[model samples]
Target: MGVFKLPWSLLKDINKVMRNFWWGQVEEERKIHWVSWKTMGKLKTAGGMGFRESHSFNLAMLAKQGWKLLHHPQALASLVLKAKYFPHSEFFQAKLGSKPSFIWRSIMDARELVKRGTRWRVGNGEAIKIWEDKWVPKLPYAKIMSPVRVLSPEAFVSILIDPGTKQWKTSMVEDLFLPEEATLIKQIPISFNNSPDKLIWSGCMAPVLKETSKMFLPKPTIKNLIKELEDSGGKELVEEFAVVARRDAAVDRIQCKIGIGLIIRDWNGRVVATSRKFRPLFPDPLLAEAMGAIEASCFGLQLGIKRIILEGDSKIVISAINNREENWSAMGMLIEDVKIKLNSYEEWSASHVRREGNQAAHKLARDALLHSISSVDMGIISHCIHDCN
Candidate 1:
C-alpha cells in the first residue's frame, strides 16, 4: 500500500467485509449494526472507537510516497519518479503528462493532503517567494494578500529582512503591506540562524513520513454520518440543543489560592446557570483554566445539556484542547483529564475568547476569592450576569 495506491473499489469492498466482521455477521447472515462504520472510524476523543477506514488509510499510505517525493529528493524512489514524470519541473509544478503510470498517478493524487499539511519554513529565505509560497503559519496554502502588481514576482522573503542586523526590515514591510498584513508578517519569525528554507508539516515538528499514521486519518466525518442517520429516520440523533458558556480562572500567587468560574447562557445572552469554586492551590494559571473548563463541562452534564460551546480566556489551554496536542507541561496530566471528561458530551467545542468577552466569568472567579467561598451557585452570581450586559 505504501508503494502503490489501492483501487478505490477494492478498498471499499474490503471495508464492507471488515464492517460485517466487526459486528459478527457472516456472508449469509444479516445482522443489525449498533453503529455505522463511518462513526466507528472517528477519533476516540470524538466519541468514536478509532477504527481505521480502508480508503482513507490507503490515501494516507500513498501520501507518504508524495511526501518523500517532495522532501526527500535524494531517495531512490523519488529519483526514479522524478526521472520518469517530472524531470523538467518540481513535484508541485509537474504536469500530468500523456498516459501516466498507475503508481505515478496514485502519488500525484495524494499531493493535496501533503500540501495541506506542509508549509515553507523560511531561513535565509532565498528559496521562498513572498507572493507565491506559503510561509505564514496562521494562513496555510495562502500567499500574502496584496495586489500582485505592487510586488515583483521574483521578490524573495530575504528582501523583507535586514541582512546586517538579522531583523525584519520593518519600514520596508510597512510600505509593502497593509497595516493588518504587516502585523501578520511580523508574527512570522525570520531567522539567519537556521538552515535554508525547508518544508515542515504544520502539526508536527518533523516532515510527515509513512510512519505518521495520524496524519492520514480523515478529519471527523461525523457530519455526513449524521445526515445519513437523519435521512434514515434517526432525526433525533442530528438534533443538538446548543448553549454558549464562558469560563475563567483567577490565581492569587502570594496566597496559593485558585478560583474558577463559569456562566452558561442562551443565544439571547440570558444566563441559565453560573457557578464558582475555590481551590486550595494551583501551580499555574493554565491548570486553573483547565479546571474551570472541567467544572463547566461537568456542570453542563449535570444539567443534561447535550451541546456546549465552552469559551475560555486562556488561549494556550483552548488551543491545546482544540488541536488535541499532547500537553507536556506541569498541567499536561490535568489537561488530559479535562479532555477525557469532555468526551462524555454528544457535541462540544472549546474556544478562546478575549479577556473583555469573558468579564462575567472573570469577575465571578475573583468574587470566589473575596468571599472566601468554596462554591457559589447561579443565585449568588446574579450580579455577574448584569455586569455582562
Candidate 2:
C-alpha cells in the first residue's frame, strides 16, 4: 500500500479478509461481527482499539511518500523521480502530462494531502509570495485572511518586516490586512537573526518548537499541551494553589517514588507558598502518583488551605479521579483511595498537567532515588519554596 496505490476492490477484499480473521471465520464461513469495523478502527482514547481505516491509511501512506520526495530531494529515489517526472520543475510545481506511469500518477494524487498539511514558517521570508503562499499560522492553510488584488507577483513576506528594527512593519501590515488579521500577524514570532524561511508540516509541528519539517515526529507531551494553552491565553484563569505531582518508577530496581509540588498564588501573581516533597517508595509509579495525590491532600489540609486544585502528570490517575466512577483495574482501588482523600477538602478538583508545568515535583521525585527516608517535612525543603511579595 505504501509502495503503490491499491485498487478499491483490492482494498475492500483485504478489509473483508481482516474482518473474517478478527471474527475467527474462514473464507468459506460467515459469522456475526460483534463490533463494526468502524468502531474497531477508532483510537483507544475514543474507547476502541486504534486500527487503521484501510482507505485513509493508504492515502496517508502515499502522502508520506510524496512528502519524502518533496523534502528529500537529494535522496537517490527522490533524485530518480525528479529526473523522470519533474526534470524541468520543482516537486511542488510539477505538472501532469498526457501519459505518466501508474506509480507517478499515484504519487501525484497523494501530493494534494501533503500540500494541505504543510505551511511556510516565515524567517527572512525572501522566497514566499505574500498572497500565493501559506504562512499565516492561525488561518487555514496559513493563507491570507482576505484576498489582495494589488499584490505583485514577486511580493515577499519580507515586505511585512522592517529592515531597520527587524520587527513587523505595523503600518504595512495594517495597510495589507484586515483588523483581525493584522492583530494575528503581530502575535507571530519574528527573528532578527535572518534565518531562512522553513516549510512546516502541520501534523508534526509543536507549539514549543514552532515547526518541524521531519517525516517522523514525537508525540505531543503534556508539556506541549501546557505550552499551547499558555500561548492561547487560556492558563490565566488558574490563579489558586495548584498541587502538582509527578511519579517515577524504576522497573529494574522495583522501586517507585512520587514527588509533590505546590503553587499558591493570588490573582496579583504573588506566590503564597511553594513547596516540594518526596514520598517513600511504592510498588509502581501509578501507586506512587495516587499516593502523591493523597499526600498532597493531607499537606493542604494541614496548611488549612480550604480551596485546592490537585494536579498530576499522570493522565490515567487524574482521569480516573475525574471520571467520578469506580475503576476496577489494578490502580482502581488506589485511585478510589485518592478520591476519598480529595473529598475531604472543602473545595477541591483534580486535573492533569504536562510534566513541564510539574517540573518542580518531577525534580523532587528524581531526588528521592538517592534517599532512604520514607517522608520529609515541607520545612526540610524550605529552600525550594518561593514566596512572592
Candidate 3:
C-alpha cells in the first residue's frame, strides 16, 4: 500500500470478504448486515466503530511516502525520483511528465489529500505565500479570509512580520486582514529563535482525528451542569462539611490590578470566611482567575478546612485547573500553582459557574476594586455583597 495504489476491484473484494465474515455469512448463508461499511468506517466518536477502508487507507499510506519525500529530499529514493521525475521543482509542485513510474503515479494521486490535510507553521515566513498558503490554524480553512486588495497576489507572509523583533507586525496585520483574522494571527505564538517555516499536519488529519471527534457532539452548558450537581444530593454532601469556595477576580483598569474575592460557605450556606486580595494585572483574564483560585485554596487551608468545592465564573481557568495535561501557555506557572494548591486538600473539586450564579463572589470582587476595604468578617461579608450589588 505504501509503494503502490491498490486496484479498486481488489479493495472491493477485500471489503466484501470482511463484511461477509462480520455478518456470519460464510458458506453462502446470508445474515443481517445491520450497518453499511461506509458508516462503519467512520471514527468511533462520530457514532461509528472506527474501521479502516482499504482503498482510502492505502492512499493515506502512499501520501505518507510523499510526505517523507518532502522532509527527506536527500534520501536515495527521493534523489532518484527527483532527478527523474521533477528535476526543476519540488514534489508538491511536480507534474506528470510524458511517462511516470507506478510509484510516482500512486504518490501523486494522493497529493491533493496530503495538501488538504496539512498547513504551514509560520516562522520567518519567507517561503509561505500570504494569500495562497494555509498558515492560520485558527481560521476555518487555515487561510486568510479577508478579500485581497492592497497587497499583491504574490505577497509573502514575511511582509506581515517584524524583522528585528521576530514578532507579528500588529498594525500591518490588522490593516491587511479582518479584525477577527488579525486577532487570531496575533494569537499564533511567534518563535523568538526565528525558525524556518515548515509544513505541519492540520487538525482535520488522522493525527488529531480521535481528539477532534468529540468536538462534533453537543455539550451541556456550565449553568445546567452546576445546577444538576447541586440538585443531585450536593446539599447532603455539602452538609457533610464539604465547604463551597466561591472565587472571583475584578479587573481595575485605573489601578492596573486584579482584585480577588473569596467567599467560603459552610453546610448551611452561611459564610465561614471571606478574603480580598490584590495582584498586579496579567495579560489575560484567565491568569487573574487562576490566581483567584489559588487564593481560594489558601483561604480554605488557613482556616484548616479539609474538603472543598471550589467554584469560579471563568470556565477556562476552572477547566485548566482540572485538566491533567501539562499547561505550556503564558499562565502555565499560575495554573500549575493552582493545581498544586487544590491537590493539597484531602478532598477538592473545581466547578465552573455563570457570572450570575457566582453573584456573591462577583460582588465582593467589585467591592474590593471600588473601595479600599481589604478583608471583612464573615458576618459583614454578606451585607457587603448585598450593598455592592
Candidate 4:
C-alpha cells in the first residue's frame, strides 16, 4: 500500500535508456535512490514490464487478509481457527487476554478469522491441516483471481490471499482495515478519477474489496442513560452529580439537615459569635467563623488588642460555602475568599471547637431568642409578607 505512494514517473521503464532516464530523474531531478533489477520486462511465463513486485504485493495482500480475517471470517482462516482453539466456542482468546468481557469476546471471534494460524493435533500427534483439499473445490478461489481463468463475478468476491502459502483468505480484505485507516489517516484531499489503474482497484485480483460495513454506532442517548440510572444501583451518585451541576446557575441555599450540639459562652456579653437552628450549613458556618476571624483580626488593626481566638462549633456553617452538592464543594472557594478578607486583620484563625468548648457562640444564640416577642422592639427580626392580587 505504501508503495503506491511512489511517484508514477519513477515507475521502472522497459528499455535500458528509459530505466536510466527514470533513475536519473530521481537522482538529479527528484534526488532519490531509484534502485531496480538490472534486467527489465520479462516474458509472460517469467512474469515481468510485466514487472510485478512479487514480494511486496504478497506482503500487502497478506496484511489485508490478516486485517479481514480479524474482523469477518468465513474463509479458510475461520476453518483454521475453529479446528484449533475455539472448537466448541464462538471466540478464542490470546494468552494475555484470557479473561475478557463478552462484548470483547465477540470482537475477538472476528479477529480470529483473520489470523487463523495452525496448531498441532492433540490425540493423533500430527499438525491438523487448517487448509485442506476438501476446503477448496479445484481451487475455487484461484480460478476467480487467476489471470488464466475466464472472468467470473463469483471470482470478484473471493481471492487466494496467499497463493504460495495455499492460505486462501476470503475476499473483501481491504474493506476491513482500510476503513479503520481512513478514520486515522487525516491529510489534504486529492481528486480521484476512479481509474482501474488506481492501486485501490488493483485489489480486484485479490479477495477483499474496500469495506462497506456500516459501523454499529451506540444508540443509547442521554434519555436512555437516564433510564439506566433509574435502574442502576449507582443512581445516587448520578443524582449527586446532577445536584453539583446546578451550582453553575442556581442561587439558593440548598436544603440541608444537620446535627447540633450547642453551647453558650459568658452570660454577660460574648454575643458576636452566635448560632441558631439554621446554623450547620457549611460555608455559612465557615463564613461566620471566617467573619469572626476577620473581626478578631480587626481588633488588632483597629484597637491593637493582641489576645484573640475566633471559634465555632458549627463546622458546616463556618465553612461559609454554598454548593448544590451536599459535600464541601463550596468550602474551598469560600475559604479562599474568607482568607483574603482575614488578611486585612493582623492575626486570627477560625478554630473548630467542640460544642462544650464553643459556649460563647452557642450562648449568644440561646440568649438572642430569650427576649419576649411583645416586650422588646419586636419588629427587629419581623417582616410583613405582602400578598399581591
Once superposed on the true structure, which residue ranges of model 3 sit more than 4 Å away at CA?
204-389
TM-score of each: 0.52, 0.53, 0.55, 0.20
For residue 326, what is the lDDT in candidate 2?
A: 34
Q: Which of candidates 2 and 4 is the stronger one according to TM-score? A: 2
Whole-model lDDT per candidate:
0.71, 0.62, 0.75, 0.31
Local error of candidate 1 at 376, Å?
46
lDDT of 2 by residue, 1-389 (tens): 78678899988888887788888756677678999999999999997878787887888999988888866789998998889888998878998666888888888888889889877766677868888888775676678856675667668998888878767888888887887677667645454346556666754321211133222111223345446667777655444423332332221134334444444444354444444555433235554566566666666667777656677787766666766433434344445556666666655666677877665566545444445333444323333322212
Estimate the TM-score for candidate 1.
0.52
Q: Judged by TM-score relative to the true structure, which candidate is superior, 2 or 3?
A: 3
Off by over 4 Å in 2: 25-29, 207-389
* Candidate 4 residue-wise lDDT, 33-92, digit = tens: 344443334545664435445333333444454344333567775566445546555432
Candidate 4, residue 373: Cα displacement in angstroms equals: 12
Checking candidate 1 for backbone clashes, the offending pairs are none
Ranking by lDDT: 3, 1, 2, 4
Candidate 2 colliding pairs: 222-354
How would the candidate models be sorted by TM-score, starting from the highest?
3, 2, 1, 4
Any residue pairs clashing in model 3, and if so which?
Answer: none
- Local distance difference test, candidate 3: 0.75
Q: Lowest summed lDDT over 10 consecutive residues: which window, candidate 4? A: 243-252
